[model samples]
Target chain A: MTWGIIGTWRMVHDGLVAASKMLQENKRVGDAIEECVKAVEDYPYYKSVGYGGLPNEEGILEMDAAFMDGDTFEIGGVAGIVDAKNPVSVARALSKQKFNSFRVGEGATKFARLAGFECGNMLTERARRTWELRLDEVKKNNLNPYDGHDTVGVIGLDLSGSMAVATSSSGLFMKKAGRVGDSPLSGSGFYVDSEIGGATATGLGEDLMKGCLSYEIVRLMGEGLSPQAAADKAVYGFHHKLRKRYGKAGAFSLICMNLKGEWGVATNVDFTFSVANESAAPAIYFAKMGQNDTTVIEPITEEWLAAYEKRIKQPIE
Target chain B: MTWGIIGTWRMVHDGLVAASKMLQENKRVGDAIEECVKAVEDYPYYKSVGYGGLPNEEGILEMDAAFMDGDTFEIGGVAGIVDAKNPVSVARALSKQKFNSFRVGEGATKFARLAGFECGNMLTERARRTWELRLDEVKKNNLNPYDGHDTVGVIGLDLSGSMAVATSSSGLFMKKAGRVGDSPLSGSGFYVDSEIGGATATGLGEDLMKGCLSYEIVRLMGEGLSPQAAADKAVYGFHHKLRKRYGKAGAFSLICMNLKGEWGVATNVDFTFSVANESAAPAIYFAKMGQNDTTVIEPITEEWLAAYEKRIKQPIE
Candidate 1:
């Protein structure tokens, strides 16, 4: 069997590297997924996910996260979690709780406190700066079209053919207090069935949730579609149906994997994701709408942006 | 064109009847759904859902609710909402919000306050008595096998072929404070699409979320499975996969409809849901496992339990 890890964007480069090393050392996919998510949760550079991340309109940090064990189909999640350092870990804890598979808000915060999770300010200076800059842009009718930037979804395939997925996010910047998106909801952000495959999504959570994007991809894969085709169809549907309601609220991007360890990605917008297997260094790849070819690899270096620009050739509107 | 409403159990009979009345009066499906959910949220006798219904282990009334407009595919939800008298209405408000589609916890509470909702004690005397009695039973290792009872899911289809679904819950009885279930999550407790129809679910939220139960049923219906057959397959799958990890925590139940106005219900366990159409009074129907035929209607009477007993002929255990 083969093993691999995939995540959204170069921002999670460290997380991808860690997950790759764990797989290289023959760790279980569950452990690898948790490790990757935990690493990303600690990385302050990314404003949309984990500790020290973006805050809501009230300047409060409320996060959402979910974890799924592919073999057992056991899933746990927490939404609008405040004062918790690692929502990903808190989600893992809730997953193992006997009577509850999900928690939210004050209840999530209280549970984390009882579970021995540290409570403190997760806001970093970097996030505050980004929030202020974005707020100014919002006032000028120039909203940031970076809804996809708010999530760090990690999927791992172990050598034993098992899979696991973890998704964590601080959610939309300056969102209404208590606002929740697709990050913590099952089937919307992440879904796994060991018999079929696994899927994780990044985009506007509202769009993803309405389309049930991740689960749709996994279901399509089960019905004999390739992971790439499944993802393409789901993203296409997400964009198609959403435009009929709200005009172009960003596009969904997805990374999908089947039981055979084959991985693919598709997106309605120009986007990049990181992939790593035992054979090589973790690398960045680009996927875009209407692309004929399925997957392409690029070095995880300075040339990455140049290569992505060449691949799409069109400016991001 | 016709209009109808369906909900879990007799406790929601009043709500279903109200929704039917509104539809008969030419109200939109969206408005009818909201009205039904609000009625359930106010009813007091039911221990599993709505205001003054039940409390978590910490004696908190953390509620979850969602509203979906089938034609538009727009969804709004709030989880772990506290001190809001009508979480269903709050969820409706979130559904109409400009940017965010969901909110939870303190944030949900704050939004509800801003939206002109009354914030007060939602607990009542009957609920306290139930909690005390249930707590005693729980201490004796007699857990309430009623996670399914946590939700009041309502689906409405108007004569115009439009559909809408609303789900609300006080959440699992004596659950961890802030615990959330299938009610507020799209594709779990409810999912609707104008072209394909809609589905609403009740049961273990975790199992439903992992299986994407409601969405699966709707998809099966889309693939030409009759509503009954589609619900059967989804319930069967929900039971099959969940049993591999947790033994018999109560199987999921689903109610499905197609654009043609045909409806069906299915479950792994014996279940009875309330239904109301354009004609006649709100009624009760039975659907049991291992039956040759699915969907049997019975008189809506005081002897619902005894009539259900006659239909199943098998003990719940």
Candidate 2:
């Protein structure tokens, strides 16, 4: 049986549902879902995804999130959310509160925090160290730090014929106080259909919003293109036309997991992200800079996976 | 006069020669040349153009500059400059230098200071204020401030039938420590031919270097489109295609002054830039949020211009 799911910010809620169901049945599916959730929970930048997100120029971390269940076409989304421990919960709340659609903001954070999760903090020390070094350079060069740039995205497909896609971001730091990137914009930042595959995007939000590159990639998958091919074509479409009009100032990175259980990722930047398959524990695949000779795939360990799962499933309290 | 100027960073050097000669012979032409130079010198962000450029990620404000003389196909450019008060001088130096180019890095600031100009201290109080505001926002949101994004560009063509393009920037805030943007990359960021008018670009340096959108706009001008139309098309091409593929991200604002002495500028961001014709003084322009309205063009007065020019031209000492 084939299924389909599609969305940008709503996909996280859908993933939670899928995970809940999987937990009631098989350990592997539950484990994978749990790992993903924890990945966002533990990663400092993950605040862009869940409850703790970076604020705009106004010093407010308003956030957006989405999740989708490929098999049911079920979706969840939340926009302009503040105080929500994770935008994912607002998505889930939407799924449960409204029959087919729902939206929430302002009170959502308090609601999620009340539901029992700890709020996230600033970027990790490791990430902070990395940023400080870069900041020093910026200071030396006298450049503005609020210039719009950066975001995060994720996509996954399970062997049981379920597809999921999720995106979360704090948006451009010091933006005009209320700017939103494509991270929460469906079709632009992400899309998934069990009949085809799954894809998630990152880059210049405005242009991405215009191109609908993520959904376009999934549509190409429906046309029978391999995951990689779909991603490549979608990216190509934007590069060829949009860059010309806008100037060479934006990028897109995507991951596609097809119905066949095969996965592919493509990006214009030096690095992107991916975790290992079930049995292939202890490895995570990262696209490194200047290593264009061949693909480099790393490993994730079972121990790490176990800890990650614990981190995710544990109550935020 | 339909000549195509090519090369990496030499176009600016060539442009200065044409501009200098034009300045000496025609009053209107001289005024325009002076305006172009003043634009760089006065704009606080234009450290890469005049003197007092902030260091690169490596604590070195090595600079590169170029000038394009549209009428003569003459170009001038200088690269790896340090402490040089005015890169335009190098463009002037190009006319006398045997190789038609010069590299000033170490002692470049010393050279400028020794030339009786103030050197060092590129960061202004205004820039520091902007940086602080951005840092506060970043800290509040927990974002990484050094994530690479900084460059500025200017292009103009006078009613007198002379066109000039210039770019100034501190390069990427924390790049590889020696990276350069499209600003100094001929045919990419800056391109001009009096027969077709002129163009200047800003955005992801490497991708812009590869795409050559500026020259493409000039080519479009050659194909008989208005300067504005040509610039729009070129920017559109990049926004749609190149941006997504290279994970590149930035906004490009370009202005073209045609042989008919008309000017055109286009951008994808809400607050891109400001423009002033010969009849008007330079001021900042910003687009209203969520609206596709014409940018809010502010006008500067002669008094302001005089003060600005005085401040910018005063010896750096």
Candidate 3:
């Protein structure tokens, strides 16, 4: 069976590589996606995800994560979890919990501890330095809020033909304590259907929640659009919707994959992603949507449809 | 313009009547939905929503609420909020807040306080009696854990043809503290789109979250299905998806309305709702779905589609 994995940002390149190894060892789709997201969280450069990531305004490290197994259609998630080094793992455990599908805050922390996970400080020195600097900036520049865009998510299609997705984030740097974004919540940040495929989103969780962006991408794909086409349309729709209300929109990026292994990434702002499959080694690729790009990447337009109609009438090239 | 409001349970009858009065007074769709949800939350009988509802296992009253404005395509919500008299009002304020779309836990409490909302204990004698009884039942029974359904939600259409939906719940009785259900989440418990319509859900939030039930119903309505048909299909889909794993499914109820003011309700378990429109006074309705029903509610199937097609093609008398 054709299988692959895709995620947003260059930080995930290492994660894709590690995930490829798990696949080589015949790991399950759900396990591999969790590991991939965990690997990215382990990386230090992308300070918006994993351990030692950015802290909330109260100087506490609150994190959110979600894990889904498409074959079973079972999902586990934890939000506002503190002192959990690998929140993704906690989410995985919660997915298997007999009586619950999601847990949050002290409840989440308690679940993590009861699930045999360590509950200790996750803040690192590096993150502390940045937190101090951000706190000072907040005091001086009237910048009580900030945003970061390094969420690590992974969607994998395994040899068993089962698909899975996982996402983890520390949310906006210095965000209000107990402020949850779209990450741990399904449909908005991530969605998977064994029949149609799956999608994961990154960027501003607030806008993504408004549109339920990832689920819309999968829904469009189910309606016969190609993965690339679906991502394009979903991104365009989000941008159009957000622009009308806010005058300008924040960044939004999406990665979509069908069970057949076909995949695509779309973004309102330029972003990078990593992919891995049997045909090639894990590698980084750029989806150029912002000003730096010379090419215009537009969603399916009437002109494109018209050109396709005309092509059918012409001789084979 | 045709304007209406629909909500879960007979308890919402008063709220619907109040909302209809607001619409008659030319209130905005967003405002009416918020006010209706608040009115329900203020009701003392519905022990699953708003202040003084069933407390969590920790004896804390954590409430969840979501508000979506279809005209603006904007949403705001609060989850695991404590000590706020009206979590629905907090959600409304968040929707108008310039910087954030969601808040949860202590952060949500602080935001409410800063926004001039009173924060104090909401526990009531009636709810406390139930909580104490349920806690004893939990201790004595060898029974598998049980789930309850008492969430209250409201969807409204305004004279301007805009749509809005809101949901509020204390979640499952004695649930883990900080455990969020579908209520405050956009897509799962409620979804609104001016172009299509809106949907709200009740019953098990975990299952609802897995299916993104409200959004799916709205999506089906967008795909040309009538509101009743869409709700039926959504409930059936949810059942089919859930039964495969658990061997049984939990209660799921839905209320849907199109932009034209046509509305419908469906539930796998017998449930009642209240509706109000410009054409009539507020009234209670029942949507009963169970084994005893002669006509089985089935998911989208070829036979069903064929029958639908035939019905449409029949000559009008």
Candidate 4:
């Protein structure tokens, strides 16, 4: 049986491995994709996704998430939702509805509660301390507090040839109340087609939404481009075009997988991602821009893993 | 001078004519696009946009709108906003921000207040009466209350070679609180590029976002297809694909204008729209799906106009 899973960011590596094992056990695409993302959401170490994720400017841990089923083209999303244990699950449930599938703010919370989904305060003491320190740092240094937002996006292709994609994020740290990134927005944050493939994005959502890079990558795959070629053409082409048109482009990274279990990635900034397929076991890789509008990727090293472990667990102060 | 304006709905005909006069006067693209949609938003008879729009299930009138600048790809949007006199104007203002450009729910309302934009109760007496009657009808006849959602989208090309697009809607009538449609979404609701032109969508936002038709139309235009061919290929093509994949497709209409003052439109249901250019006077036209996956367009008849006027103002039962 051939099945695969690919996800944005190095943080999802642990979850992808478990999900990949489930795929090996013949899990459904939607269940496997949700499992991959929900694990990351439950982990308290990742600061840009769920639970311990950073808060907005008003000290609120608002979240965004979306799920899409490739076979039915059913999509559901939530923006600026708070106190949800697993937003990916909420999005998956919403996808089954033809109307009111996408909700925002308190309305999203209401839907979660009315649907009998578990809820709790998502803020963490460590996260709160980090927010305080960051606020002080910005006040003292006069620096931009809007930086380092990484959305956990996972795409899964099951043995049944079904595909699904899900994304979750706490959004840009220190963002204004009710501010939403592309994580919950279709085409911008993610797009998947079981017959062709799927793609997802992370980085500066304000810039990512401007290009619709995720949909473009999938369309290219459907047109017979290899996953690598499609990712390169879509990401680099848009990165250059945005810079020329908008004067400068913000950082963004994208990953894609085709129906054949082949995968690819591209980014304007240094990025690390995880992937597992029939030909490869779940593993992390680092990527960066190369010469001639391409991406250079290499397997992650033990040194990097050790440092990341220390960095995430460092004292809040 | 080469300039033009195209807007969805016969309701925007008056606004399009006024904005067309401004475009002829060498008004900037952004200003003209805003003027076009704001008119419909302020009009009481246009119950699906801005003031006097239908309320949600909770009886609160929430609005969604978006603005995009073609030259810079700057986009700003608000979803589930309330009591805003001109949602398109607020969206246009948010487009100027580098961060937190998209706001939702009460946060969107708070941003409007902080920005000093005008505000008023969007729910009108007539709209309330209609909502109450619709609720009764749904309960009595077991009818789906979610019907007749039309977003007013406008695209403009100015003499200075700039282009912009804006969309505003009250979303699906009798929707749940905070339910957002494609009106506030990028790529789905609107996309513009001075080099390639722009496209905006109306009708069934939930289904529209699945195809990212606006981005696909602009992409097709970028690949050298004419505006009409692009619209036909994208709209008709996606309509069939969605039906095949999702088992059904919803009503949708799209309008596009290239950089050369050329325009096109396609729809899956009965639709009316208005357009004007340097070569023609502003006029409303009717469109519907034709044989062989094409759009049939013709000038609106005087009888249709009189009937529409009577239909909007008839006493509620």
Candidate of highest DockQ: 4
lDDT of each: 0.78, 0.49, 0.80, 0.93
TM-score of chain A of each: 0.88, 0.69, 0.88, 0.99
TM-score of each: 0.91, 0.40, 0.90, 0.99
Compute the lDDT of residue B240 as modeled in candidate 2.
52
Model 2 stretches with alpha carbons more than 4 Å out? A1-35, A42-53, A96-142, A147-152, A288-317, B1-317
Model 1 chain A is weakest, by summed lDDT over 10 consecutive residues, at A308-317
lDDT of 4 by residue, A1-317 (tens): 58999999989998899999998899898998898899999999899999999999889999999999999999999999999999999999999989999999989999999999999999999989999999999999999999778999999999999999999999999999999999999999999999899999999988999999999999999999999999999999999999998889999999999888899999999999999998899999999999998899999999999999999999876
Question: In model 3, which regions exceed 4 Å deviation?
Answer: A290-317, B245-247, B290-317
Per-residue accuracy of model 2 over A216-252 as CA lDDT, tens digit each? 6776787888876676766765565545543453555
Candidate 4 residue-wise lDDT, B224-253, digit = tens: 999999999999999999999999999999
Strongest candidate by TM-score: 4
Which segments of candidate 1 are over 4 A away from where they belong? A133-148, A245-249, A278-280, A291-301, A304-317, B136-148, B245-249, B278-281, B291-302, B305-317
Better of 2 and 3 by DockQ: 3
DockQ of each: 0.67, 0.02, 0.40, 0.88
Interface RMSD (Å), every candidate: 1.6, 20.8, 2.0, 0.6
Mind giving the per-residue lDDT tens digits that candidate 1 earns over A1-317?
Answer: 88878888766667788888888888898888888888888876566787768788667778999999888777889888888888988898788765687988877888889889877889876667666766777778876423434588988888888888999998888887878888888999999887788899887787788878889988899998988778877777667667876555555688888877677788776677888776657877766666453434444456766664464333222
Model 3, span B1-317: residue lDDT tens: 88888888766777788888898788898888777888878766567887658888777888888888887767889888888888988888788754556887777888888889877888887777777777777789954545665688888998888899988998988787777888888899999988889999998877777788898889899899998889888788668767885456777788989988888777888677888787767877666775532123332345644664575345323
Error of 1 at B48 (Å): 2.1
Error of 2 at B11 (Å): 54
TM-score of chain A of 1: 0.88
Predicted candidate 2 versus true structure: per-residue lDDT over B1-317, tens digit per residue: 11111111111323333433344445344234534454454455433344334444345445655555554433444444554555654443342321212222322233345446444555555434444565567679976544333344455454455565655555544332333455554565676666566677655454444345676677678789886667667676555554453344355555556665555555555333444343443344332222232223333346755664575456442
Q: C-alpha displacement of A142 in model 1, angstroms?
A: 8.9
